[model samples]
Target: MAFLDIDALVGLFPGQGGYRKGALASFWDEGDPVLRGVLAEIDEVALRVLGTDIGSQIFGPAAAIPEGPELFQLAVYTVSVATYELLRVREVEFGLLVGHSMGEFAALVAGGALTVAQGAEMLCHRIAATAGTSGGMLSLSCDVRRVEQILDLAAEPHVVVAVVNGRSQVVVSGPEQGLARIGAVADALGLPAVRLPAPAPFHNDLMSGVRTEVVKRLGRVRCAPTRTPVYSPILGRCYRGDDDLVDILGMHLVTPVRFDTTITRLHEAGARVFMEVGAGRTLTGLVKAAHPQVVILPALTEPAAVDTEDTDEPVDVPSPQPSTTDEEVMAQLRAIYAAALDYPEDVLTADAHLEAELGVDSVKRIQLLGRVGRHFGLEPSAVNGIADHETLGDIAGQVIASLEASGGR
Candidate 1:
């Protein structure tokens, strides 16, 4: 049972529920206004815990949301102890299964029900379950019947009602024209409707006939059960260990997902630990928000501790006090540089260009500047001449000088 690296999972599933890194950062930074604040906090936690490892970089800060390393950690913690042993030894188990969506493939592969290559194929085929299907996902604070009325008004040639989330939120998908018509009706009714940040509309009548396509793909793949339990979102119950997965998997393409009920049933069935494996806190956060008593954790946040060579007792350096006014500013500059680089003061040079000398990239530069601004807790743009600074030390000097000029302690 070898432990699965979170980054490997990212490489495995590209452009699925979430974009890779480039899209991830933007999604957090600017993509969706609603996700910005939440993403920022998530990013902070990620950087602090994961450091600058391959998993974090590959997943990035934003796109990582759906299937981020954090979710993988959660799965590791909550899954069966035997599964943990397999992960420890890089072995596979076939008895473990997943709840729904592409996440199922990940769980199946991890459980050894499917080979890694088979999992990859299944995921690719699963994409067909929604590929090229034009429809929009709208979140509503109502149930399916009410949502259908909104869809009825839209009455476009291509509209399809999609997922039903929780008691209040329902997502609709169909042709954009139909969706637009629906939106107008929703507006007239004064009901809030927002489009989802997804590429394809899913789980509607539009996919009802797509089973042939899915069955063909599913047949080509070999499957087995380690007798792992699969909780069906559609049935609001668990499929018997020996239930026919092939048929159920095909039907899933067109079924309405009862995620809320399924989760509730899991708890009722005594599933104390709910680990949302793969990526994103989407499920875990929802689970935690819905059921705060449950323990929710993600794998990405379990960052490997910093590696050090010496085991000797560490020595603490005395705090150095400046002997003069200029020296005080210099000391502050050193502090600023250390904080900006997330490194030691000895590494930063006053004249060294931050980008060229310290090798800071665009993301790192923005993060550093953001940190500096927060540390000063003022309008960073107010520091007029500091933009021309070459290094962290220079920026620090300008910041301190401005603070002093403004009578800031």
Candidate 2:
């Protein structure tokens, strides 16, 4: 690849929720000093701060994704900094750097504000501080204006508009009840809404207290000015030498991530090429959604076959307008049943009966509910109750109702 002009290559460090085991296998296989040295420091920090060799949790094979949010954060931070180091050695000069949500720490490290170990330790501290919140995040496929309408529709809204990732995509985080209400309203408007299986409600008023804990836990660590211009979307500013790092990072948990605005500002500053400098293409896809004309790069997107497995992403039903058609909802439902039953999606129509037409009796439903419930993140009772509803549309209603009554995001 030809080197882009200086200050033209924008490094976009991703924040959270994209993890694949052994994502760094390719890098490790190269025995590159940059990757090796960064991971070594991070492992020491993990041992001192988190009491586990997260290196194994990160580099080893996985039967499952780590349920703990801390491991996920640490892994992403490690990969982002290591990848940036590799690029730096190859003489790929970054025109600018931006960290998305969790990716801020990585960017901070890459920009020389924090050492690799310091970044990992701080991230682990964040994962620990993020626990015990009463709510989770709900992702929506609508624009910011629609979110205000949804908030007004909910009686005594408890949720806060947390993230505006793309022009149309918004994520709200708050109490479970508030999220439930928001989800119901979004569904009625034909907007795609799904509760993220996140442990806590972050980037909202409820998280304000977490700031104190982060400052307290930062302990001996210190922040320096970045070698490269490091911009934070959550803070909506660039990190400076004299700025209070505590105030910036602490407030990150409480303030919404203005990713959309940050991207706009970055683009205005002449950052045309955006690179998701970590695992997963989530930020890549989001960047595309917001600005299709800009260049997007991935530091290490292709997973090595050595010890990684692919996971299915949640399917989104395309609805150009606010209201969902019966057909659109059925499309998503059909994909679910088809995957579990190993049947073609064409066979799973709205009017098809689970028992009479599809031959899914109570006994069969008991088996099918497991797979279906996992897909929707529903409880056994919720999934089993869905089986009682006959037609595909009826099952769809039950699923929506479950989302409405759900207390977890």
Best candidate, lDDT: 2
For each candidate, the alpha-carbon lDDT, in order, equals 0.46, 0.68
lDDT (Cα, tens digit) per residue for candidate 1, span 1-409: 1222222221111112321122223333334443333234333433443332222432334323223323332222212221223233443222223444445544454454655445444444555444565654555546678887766666565566555545555667766777667766765664545554444555666766666677776674556764345444665554554555566666766666766665565555544344444333345444554566766433322211111111122223223232225555555556655554454777665765453234342223433444454555435443323433546667767766666666664
For every candidate in turn, the CA RMSD to the true structure comes to: 15.8, 10.3
For each candidate, what TM-score against the reference?
A: 0.50, 0.72
C-alpha RMSD in Å of predicted model 1 compared with the true structure: 15.8
TM-score for predicted model 1 compared with the true structure = 0.50
Where model 2 places Cα greater than 4 Å from the true spot, the runs are: 1-7, 29-31, 61-64, 301-409
* Per-residue lDDT of candidate 2, residues 304-360 (tens digit): 311111123444433222243445445767876676555678877777645423534
How far residue 188's Cα lies from its native spot in candidate 2, in Å, is 2.4
